[model samples]
Target: MVLQDLGRRINAAVNDMTRSNNLDEKAFDDMIKEICAALLSADVNVRLVGTLRKSIKASVNFASLPAAVNKKRLIQKTVFDELVKLVDPHADSFRPKKGRSNVIMFVGLQGAGKTTTCTKLARHYQTRGFKTALVCADTFRAGAFDQLKQNATKAKIPYYGSLTQTDPAVVAAEGVAKFKKERFDIIIVDTSGRHRQEEELFTEMTQIQTAVTPDQTILVLDSTIGQSAEAQSSAFKATADFGAIIITKTDGHAAGGGAISAVAATNTPIIFLGTGEHMMDLERFEPRAFVQKLLGMGDVAGLVEHVQAITKDSAGAKETYKHIAEGIYTLRDFRENITSIMKMGPLSKLSGMIPGLSNMTQGLDDEDGSLKLRRMIYIFDSMTAAELDGDGKNFVEQPSRMVRIAHGSGTTVREVEDVLSQHRMMAGMAKRVGGQKKQMQRAQNMMKGGNKDQMAAMQKRMASMGGAGGMGGMGGMPGMPDMAKMMQMMGGGQGGGGMPNLGGMDLQSMMSQMSGLMGGMGGGGGGGGGGRGRGGR
Candidate 1:
């Protein structure tokens, strides 16, 4: 809920405008005021807020737009486009290349979570196949080396630090040389911080930068500091040629907007955000998506990307995807899927990735939704080995067993029944899409091992799975082409005919065409044909 208030205010203003028959100048001005108020309330710098308003207003040209264009939509587009710029500041960021020893230095004040953010950045690259190493150069702070060592050991990442090396500059230079010699892909140097900015500390930071000659210098800012972020960001920006910024503790800070806009004002791009204590809780910062999430317009692409990343890396993930795609799911499968979803992040965060679901799932991170998930997990935990055996069909026959499970999980029998009901729904879906294993397998393969366009990849999966054939002889299998009709058409109802070779066809579009054709045929030929017609769409 970092910018929840701002999001709600902006969303309400947009919704109100959307409902209007026509948008006059007054309505537009009022919308701007609401936006400005939201940003101001979130402690955004007044100057930038004014610039944002001006940009939005300047972008709107009623006279230039054609008669067919929606005035309201144009205004909305202007708002979105300007908001993207407001946080972005068009700053260039350093992109770490693979198979190279890229040195990154983290600098921040004490209590800004700089040390933890260093590990988080290390973990980020490490998970993506980089040989990442951590260097503890915080010789100024007490136990800095120990803290970094603990974090490094926990992540299983190698580290270079010493208890005896009191000079940070010496430690940093030696650590960089050591990592470079070993040919580590990414070497992150964790520097010391002061409680408050001083000439001594700033001078130390400059000396460390000189010694290391880091490829990128990142300034870390704690988001909870509110409006003081401007001065804090300015202080760091002045000291080091900050290539990027990492705002820590953004998961629950109401002043996240202030810190973000403040740092962005320095023309330094935020590369990532520390959402939680876990290293994996770090999220790559995207300006448009950030504003979209703030406005209650969910980031669907981000959601899908997260899903693919988690499921692909997870154990038995490929199998899970295959089962779900083939509709061979079960209660056990459902439980596994639930576990995977939880691994992706909180349900509330996931919900924001889906369009139109953000508002409905607003309070999902609170007690209500979290409690529901915990209860379900507990219920699953309490199930006996025999009861959870093989697709969990045993639970279907015994109603009394649900009562026992509810008692064990410290919940109601009604909740247990709800879980069972969910299982049944999944089972029914599995049965509905049976026998498309080949297509599903192809879809699963298409989704793995890439950082390409997520929606495009999904479309390719659907299109590839819905490969050649119309709707016939495949029953209700999802994306299954009608081999019989395909061969029939290819041969033109003659002998020596077989399924057509529609090689390299975009099956997603073809499926749509086939659905329309089948619908127009209107249950012709046979009952199976009618079933195909019904399912093709």
Candidate 2:
């Protein structure tokens, strides 16, 4: 089973026990048993599973608990904390300082995706204002330098490699010297990997380590190796004395739980996870956030970070915020929001960051989700300038206009109607919250001024609105609503007659209807037919 299935099984077990009428010791034991079984099926080490079971049982002794305590909350917290402990090694990874060349070397078995990960990490740092570069030192593998060159060129990051230098160590030293002389912030050296733990590979790793003297040696382990990750990580640790780990291929059909648990047993910190093949797929691994996402609890903090990172220079976003503050959300504003979300990354990945969205889009993959978002854009593109800037009420007055748009955009009349409906809901939300412009400006100023107390108070209010204790605080960008107000609208609160009601729609229907309104939009019907429409356009 994949991680999602494992999470669902564990969640179901916990919910079952908590909702039981008895809520006795037997139900608790049964819940534990079900969770252990799920973990074992996910290829977690047998000994580690046993230890986790014991730790959870010891922490939640039903007999010792007082009758007045909230048993349900206690049990839920115990489960979340234990799962986090299972993956966290309680060790800090190396932190690179700016204005200095921080050399980071990569080591792993063959087919572990070291070359690709190097470019991904380089681009990740580069986007965050770090002058990063890549050094390809894999002389053993044919065309390794060429692969790195291709990836580096695509990412537009400077790279160093040689066609004549057969010695990996020499190439590594040269690359590091050149980049350090240029004063690069982060320099990543990609070394070759072998089929197994051979003596030649070990000696070569040592040579590269001695040549570059990297501040941090990261071991890239493939998740498909399952429980064997423990042995592989141990061998590399002894030979290269690496300081950190990065697990690749977690997005594949691999039973990643085993590899994660196995690596954690070795007391090494996992710094990042390669979630997909895209350059933007590397996710910073935080133990608590990882467990929360795995259990379908959502990671609002990650979502906020993603948004802030991608929207720092987005003028359209700034404009939309201003319009919303003025109680105005035109069709043009809706189009800009959809376009911005498309640039943020894959829709499938972003959906998981919201509390109930992942479940709603569970059946849609990345490709389908992207297509849905593009079709929404095509609909906006087909509209005339006047219609695009209008409030969408004209379409309601003349229903024939919907047919013309559907034909022009290659979408159906129903899809066009859906878009208009979503726009109306968003317009209503903006109008209702326009009165809080002063409050939003105060929150935005607090965030910009780095007022921790005010920010904390705002985050607390937002968390209460979400009913999720640890939702991350929004930065309250210019013209944007305060975090609390945004969460209130999302959670469908009743403060000043919250967001327009959806006619008592179920969770799935509500999510589908509000897809374009929420930042977590995408994933719905119109895949097969929408492709033709896009092609024609």
Work out the TM-score per prediction.
0.78, 0.83
Error of 1 at 153 (Å): 2.0
State the local distance difference test value for candidate 1. 0.69
The residue-level lDDT of candidate 1 at 393 comes to 63
For candidate 2, the TM-score is 0.83
The collision pairs in model 2 are none
Task: Name the top TM-score candidate.
Answer: 2
Each candidate: what lDDT?
Answer: 0.69, 0.77
lDDT of 2 by residue, 174-256 (tens): 99999999999999999998644489878998999999999999999887887777777888888988888998987777677
| CA displacement after TM-score superposition, residue 34 of candidate 1 (Å) | 1.1
Error of 1 at 343 (Å): 3.3
What's model 1's TM-score?
0.78
* Model 1, span 341-366: residue lDDT tens: 56766655655655566666554444
